[model samples]
Target: MTNDIIPVILWCVPRSVSTATERAFMGKEGCRCWHEPLGDPFYFSSKRQSLRYSEEECKASGNWDKDIVDVMQTLLDPEANNVGTDKKGPVKYVFVKDMAQYIIPRQTLEKIHKGQGSQCYRTDGETCGTSRCTGVDSEGEIIENPTVIPTALMRRFKHTFLVRTPTKAVPSYYKCCQDKMAGFEFFDGAEAGFEELRILYKWISNPRSTFNTDKEDGPGAVSFPGKAQKQPLPPPLIDASVLLANPASTIKHICDQTGIPFDPAMLSWDAKPQAEFAKWGAYHQGAENSTGFKCEDDGAAKTNGEEAKIAKLPQEVRNTIERNMEPYEWLVKRQTTFA
Candidate 1:
């Protein structure tokens, strides 16, 4: 919570090798790494936005009561215990890796603005703002829609992004869905997440204009409680391909930008299952099994197999990739590059 404690978040697209990126920072001195803390509220909360799981499945997953504010408070608390690891002390940096879509899904934002009420459907089939709900504030006032985290809370952290080519990311994500998420065979195009990342990037660049504007002037604009300082420089963006091709230089460049000292040890670590990633099942298997950054297609068979998988993608999946390319390229052009 002190001004000296640096909080950094790596907002990423799914299957962008983001978990591996988090792994690079795991054992660094004075660092605390959190694996998708916001994911609990986004996917399992009573007011959850995702329909990927059934009501029973969501409740069975864990307690779905915590909201965005609770999650942020925990991350920013200097005395809080670490989620997955026992490393604890005076923290110098708090690093989080999470999918941007989990923070604020594009469709959920659209639905809320269209005056359809909260998209939070409870397990009992009740909407969030109804009489039986807990959507009111402590003073018994209707709580405003939490479509996005408040601008003030967002500014607490130094934000960065991790992106992958849609052609590659889309197919990779589809495979994860098939392999990990039971009964979810087809990819949910909404979860491709480029649009949410674009919105967040623009918001972070100029939050005052994006969040403080009149409802008629900006899409999904809301009155936030605090002023958002205009960022003097754009936050760093890391392309997954670039990081894989040059792990040391790319990670060092990121460290320089984010105020962390570059360490050679970040490039390699022992292959061990991370306790934090266990909650998400096998979604992070590659990262858990990796000792260091390596080309995903290290073998000829892998190269050919990945190509064949991409070629056989369903039409909807292909369309999702096409839709995301514009945003993906926009992010790529702005990514931090190393010689």
Candidate 2:
């Protein structure tokens, strides 16, 4: 039944205006959107990799014990309730907005490269029975260079990316962390999220990759029992600035690419706080309050005191952004342009 549903994931960096992008999709008929579903498992699950939050903080936040595989299953579930909705029904399309960092934390990836097996968790939070459980194939052989979420599971979605310039994104993220109401003592620079996005993008775009080994019939040509399937078109990349500069055309372009019908009504919605976003504290306040897409006075102008702000950022934040700029620009060059 789930196979009949179209699943789309918008992998994004923090402060990339992705939540608002999710809101636009919420206005689309028959589309159900999930806001950062993988984050719960990544930050709070039993097999969690981050220690940034203490035990008390973890307990205060609900969904502190979700498994990665279980969350992935939920995303693929057609009848799963839409964000902020209790009623269940069939959905033709499922849209997920999530950070790439949540899918595979940099530290976890490093551990895998060092030959330390990260335990694979079942839906029940129990570890799988495999001896070295980075990821196991259908036949239970260990997958090399495993992502925190298995590659096989990741291949199921039509992936896309939402990127923001490090100059703007880095400062915005730091400001969020500095907000007392946002519930963080200090920012974790590792969560800047560009490196992981690049890695996933490359893996998805590579034709010779093992992720395309499925012999099932689909959009790509059919493969024999042991043959590789044809490579999929590379995922679309959307820059936050470009999306904001012209929301209607940009979103239409996105719809055209993803096989969704373009509707002008997707440009606006009732402004209110969403129950799905409440659990994250103030991180989503901007999205929660937005009535529609609006470019800031200097947003498209590109002269918005951005340089001044970047200069004031802490040295660590500056360094993180500097390290991420290469990948960020690489993605920017390939972003889908509507203008």
Candidate 3:
């Protein structure tokens, strides 16, 4: 069925004000919002099992992948939910906030192999898997097949990336987990980092390239599928620091990019947190406490001090921050700037 609602997919790292941004979108007229529907699969994946999350948590949250798929189908179906009647205005947006790392890499690879809008490196009819990356093959020649994003998902939304400097984000994230999870060990760059964000951005910008091909190849020049039509621009990148500096303006800028009207309701919300957050409130206390985009002077000062404390972090943490700098800088350059 035809519908005007735009699907807004927000990709963010932890502690990047992603929850707050989701709340802002919730306040907007004709908007339906969702938290990390993708979090469970990512947390349960083999790569992340020993990191910030635990298997016990995964067992408690069964079938997370199915949950996300159902939610996505609902959001995409114009006739599935009566979205327009919930607010005075006709529903025109579905705002979903998720982490870049939350996308299951293995699943994405599988879909690409099935030709779910993904291209790949092939020689003699042997399509390469995730291991086939950009670099010298045994023949000593450069193989440059880029890992395209899964088009089945990419075509579903106008994506936006929310980023923060590693110095500010990493410490804040570690502290959050420490407060919530008992005996949580300090994670290095491999566990808590911006590499996933960078990887996702590359795929989004070059969705026509090979999926799971290689992260290093980046978005090599590729033609959009439809002949002669202009390709859509890559998702907008919003810096948390920039958004916090001027929340209203930054949100408006983002809305414009996503083809949605800027609603004043997005600037504020109820003093109490919404019922929707109950399922994950433990991990989202900061957003729950905020009533609006306006940052208090004292709060701002405290945050600045906390950010400054990054220098005093342990050596391993410092090293992780350094490792994250490359990708963080890449996204920062592409972020939406406010005057």
The per-model lDDT (C-alpha) reads: 0.69, 0.70, 0.61
Predicted candidate 3 versus true structure: per-residue lDDT over 94-149, tens digit per residue: 78888766563533333222322212111123343554233234553323322233
Best-to-worst order by TM-score is 2, 1, 3
lDDT of 1 by residue, 129-203 (tens): 432123334554323323356545665567888899898889888888778543456567767778667656655
Q: After superposition, how far is residue 236 of candidate 1 from its true place, in Å?
A: 0.4
Per-candidate TM-score against the hidden true structure: 0.77, 0.80, 0.71
RMSD of each: 8.3, 7.5, 8.9
lDDT of 1 at 167: 80
On TM-score, the leading prediction is 2
Better of 1 and 3 by lDDT: 1
Model 3 regions lying over 4 Å from their true place: 1-3, 44-56, 64-71, 79-90, 104-149, 181-189, 207-232, 294-308
Q: Candidate 2: lDDT of 43?
A: 74
Report the lDDT tens digits of candidate 2 across residue range 133-166: 3444555333342366555556667778889988
Clash number for every model?
0, 0, 2
Please report, as a residue range, the 10-residue window in candidate 2 with the lowest summed lDDT.
221-230
